[model samples]
Target: MATTTLGVKLDDPTRERLKAAAQSIDRTPHWLIKQAIFNYLEKLESGATLLELDGSAARDNEDRGELAEDAGLQCFLDFAESIQPQSVLRAAITSAYRRPEQEVVPMLLEQARLTAPVAEATNKMAAAIAEKLRNQKSAGGRAGIVQGLLQEFSLSSQEGVALMCLAEALLRIPDKGTRDALIRDKISNGNWQPHLGNSPSLFVNAATWGLLLTGKLVATHNEAGLTSSLSRIIGRSGEPMIRKGVDMAMRLMGEQFVTGETIGEALANASRFEAKGFRYSYDMLGEAALTEHDAQKYLASYEQAIHSIGKASHGRGIYEGPGISIKLSALHPRYSRAQYERVMEELYPRLLSLTLLAKQYDIGLNIDAEEADRLELSLDLLERLCFEPQLTGWNGIGFVIQAYQKRCPYVIDYVIDLARRSRHRLMIRLVKGAYWDSEIKRAQVEGLEGYPVYTRKVYTDVSYIACARKLLAAPEVIYPQFATHNAHTLAAIYQIAGQNYYPGQYEFQCLHGMGEPLYEQVVGKVADGKLNRPCRVYAPVGTHETLLAYLVRRLLENGANTSFVNRIADHSISIQELVADPVSQIERMATQEGGFGLPHPRIPLPRDLYGAERANSSGIDMANEHRLGSLSSALLATAHNDWKAAPMLGCPAGA
Candidate 1:
């Protein structure tokens, strides 16, 4: 019989399935098909002849056994036999590959039966290990403790996996002696180098221990009044990094004042650079007054600060340069509108006198924004001050507009119209509003129709850019001081201004510590004649304690983004890395340090511990692991304490 060889043909659906299966196993479909063919051929090939002799002629006989036993030869022969005309061989092959449910179900059941005992044995081993660890812990033995604990616990599969991972880390400690040596070395050397190569778990634990130890030491020193002594020593002479950190922490925490002495030093510094065209804005700490008296005190403090700056300017032969920012709420509250009007009536006249004096000295006053309720009052005051017959000088007054407000465009238009009508030049300092969360909460509490502050930041940013362009369009409006830290937004402002041909008509402003890179970049451009606008740094001056609110705001802003935090933590290997390393600096701050710990490293208070203990005393189950971890009971206790102590403080405002 004459036989013909045929190629395999697969249907589109079957071919797609085959390709997917091959992909799943990371094999080429051609390779898979060839392998399958070889497998099938091997199963069918019995004995086969490789050659034929001429009819009726005596042939040289070759041994069939040698070739018959060859697996490759048998496969080829089987494959040739399987391919027949009109056989639908491809479909047959696919069908053969598919398992019948009847067959599969029984096989699956049998496999489960086989695996059950193995799983049981594994669990038993784990239980034994965990039990041993528990016993050892009771007997106070450290060796094999982690392994034993893992074995005894009836953990879920995931937990079991984690236990194994943790055990690997624990075993890398070498021995108790080595571990102790490492700890002792780190403590004595005052530098803890993590051995993450050994195990990630060990690295994490070691880092946590280091932070805890540092925190504990700081707390103990603070409690023992050693911090004050350290401060004194540092004040006299200390390592530059230590001095700078401590000084910054102290100044930021508001525990010390921006003293008359500090102000004098600032003036001296400014005086040295004024001849080179440097200017200064002197700000006194204290704002958010609850009463007229409080407002008056803050006002008086500003007056005093201005007077000192004036005196210093007179002596240095440098006129007061246009720079000063003031918060409106510091003048009076909205609830006391009538009283505040009277307070303002008196305060405005005095402020006008200061402005007149400042005008004579060439100092500029910028009215800063506060809560939304105070925005109207701030703008009103600004309009009056700017229009006042005595203070209409080109750069005599400036007002801040928070671009986050939905109505900022209207505010900008109003200012432009006012400038046009009054024929007085105006300066606008634009900021993205700072009190976003507070404003939203107030709106919620007051049942306001909508949040006047733009809730979405993208919208606010767009508004800011629009307002910036609008302000830049008005040549009569002084070059606005654009205060922001957002690089993209800043770049956009610059782009829009350039596109509109207002290249040299805007100045950028940023906070003191933040935006250093951006500030330097912009300033460098100005210095190199790439740009002609000025760049200003808004340096905040106050004791660290008084600046807690500001610090909190900074933390909240950074912490709002989880990705930012994770990126920071990944880069920051230690506290020093977090504080000193530029990449990890931004996200190291805790968002809510209120009850978790002290606001600053130098000021260690027992707030969290005390709250937890109080919770325990008040019938809260502090011993509950979940409660301890979550800090729920501690929070309740703190709230209760605040409620109880509020009355003793004598009034709601005082509390």
Candidate 2:
């Protein structure tokens, strides 16, 4: 075989051992190393379950840290220094993820192999419908997008996201006078905002005024005099009657949520999904807590949800966990970096309790990613819990990585390290991210630096693929779960992951109601009569009160012009563009600093909040922080407290 002579920096003992192993194998040292890599890959694929480590094994690994480092170097040499280019590494993923005729033909033939004509006919019909939708995508643009959003009744997700984006954009206007001046100018032209009277602009403006516009529409259409007669009632959804109206509309549209009055009802619905060859990670919906009371209420809800899921989950097996995704922000009002020490102290205890409960029940409790600012704090708590002795034996704890963030790859590295240290296998759900518009607008408004995310749709896609390649290769540490609807992206992942990766090693996730056809294709039986892949449906369980905002964000994602679901049917866009090889895409997008790596956010970040400190590497005991925090002791001691019948003496005096 053709190869490059890889130089190794080794001490005498290691060098002698390598020579001895080579002699024992009756092969050159390089040849033995190459064969060992092939064996490891074979070990992963041939197994029914993915690789995992135990605490004892991990401790042994730490003892042989030098050897593990050598193994890591060996992995790098094997994967990166291949005979040909490492195509998966430098690939710039195109936004459009298109499938080819040849790829479809094999699958069609596989479908024909099925015994049932009805099933074959159904598959053909689905394929035709999917193509028709793809051909129709590009023509829609802003007007098409607006109508799509409107058709969805402007609920919490993507359809409603334009409004959130608009609201965020308006926040960038620092001066109230300037904001009012712009509004007045738009009013003169019979529009709500500048250039917002028609087509796409109208859609964006409506989205910007999302809830606000919804209230107006309620008033205009209510004719019941319920809203028209009460102007404030129509405009402010937070008002009693108006909030009721919003809930009614949400239930009518289904709001892409699966909530019920009780956890049992929701789990029953989830069971139907499980029966249909899909797994679920249920999210109990609620906004970030505004007070300690709200936090306590949410904690109770979570504690109950865990108990319910654990009871329901049986007969399936280990890691077939009753997966529930949690938002830490909802667990505490003070979940911020400025309160890092206190937040960690406060949040860890609650999370630990849940983690222990999860351990008791064999359920997966994942910490979901939220806004960019809270990323550091979330990671700290997650890592702390991951390493906690209570969780060392369990494999179900998970964390989400948002590909939209520029530092997502870096985040993945940290997770892998955390898992390795703890000797735990982690489920990493890689998502394209939800709060794109918010992140962009926040950066702009803060006037700190450039955007925290990629400006182009392709950049995020590229970043996701890059991260996926890393995770999929590290099967021992991470169980990668990619949540995407883009067929092109899925196909690229399947292709690049190589023959060693089993469909079971990683999972594909789609929104509960969305991407049905795409996932059907993914997990569907092929020519060999074997299932293609297992998939997860991210199901949100919550009431109407928690539904609206989530719905708007989902709408924003779906309604965006760059979204694959939106543009898949657009005929003007070439299949090549949709499925361009990332490697070539990177070559085309090359710059002086290499391809697509942008400068860090120029605005200062709150470093204190970050779990991973940048400098001052060595931490002595928390002496300094303790001294600084001592000032708070007196304040707490002096705080108001009312109890014991308010020290009543009036009854005694009267007697």
Predictions: Cα RMSD each:
35.7, 19.3
- lDDT per residue for candidate 1 within 1-655, as digits (tens), equals 2333333445799999998998898776766887988876776685544355565243223233333333334434433333221113222322222122222222222221213443344334333322332233221222122212222221322322232222222224545444333332333333223322322344234433543444334334325556687756533433333323323332332221132234555565445334433345565555577877887777776666667666555533212243566666666543233333454565566557666766665656677777665554455566677778776545657778887675576677777776776676676889887788787665554433334565444445455666777787786655577887654445545554553444336677765434433344345444563333455555445544345455445434433432112112232333222222111121132234322111233311222223435421122222122222235333423432423334555576745
Report the error of model 1 at residue 360, Å.
2.2
- For TM-score, the strongest prediction is 2
Per-model TM values vs. the true structure = 0.47, 0.58
Residue-wise lDDT of candidate 2 within 228-346, one digit each (tens)? Answer: 54555433432334333333433433444344546787788777657757777778888799899998988999999888888888734335545788889888998875566557767
* Local error of candidate 1 at residue 638 (angstroms): 46
Ten contiguous residues with the weakest lDDT in model 1: 578-587
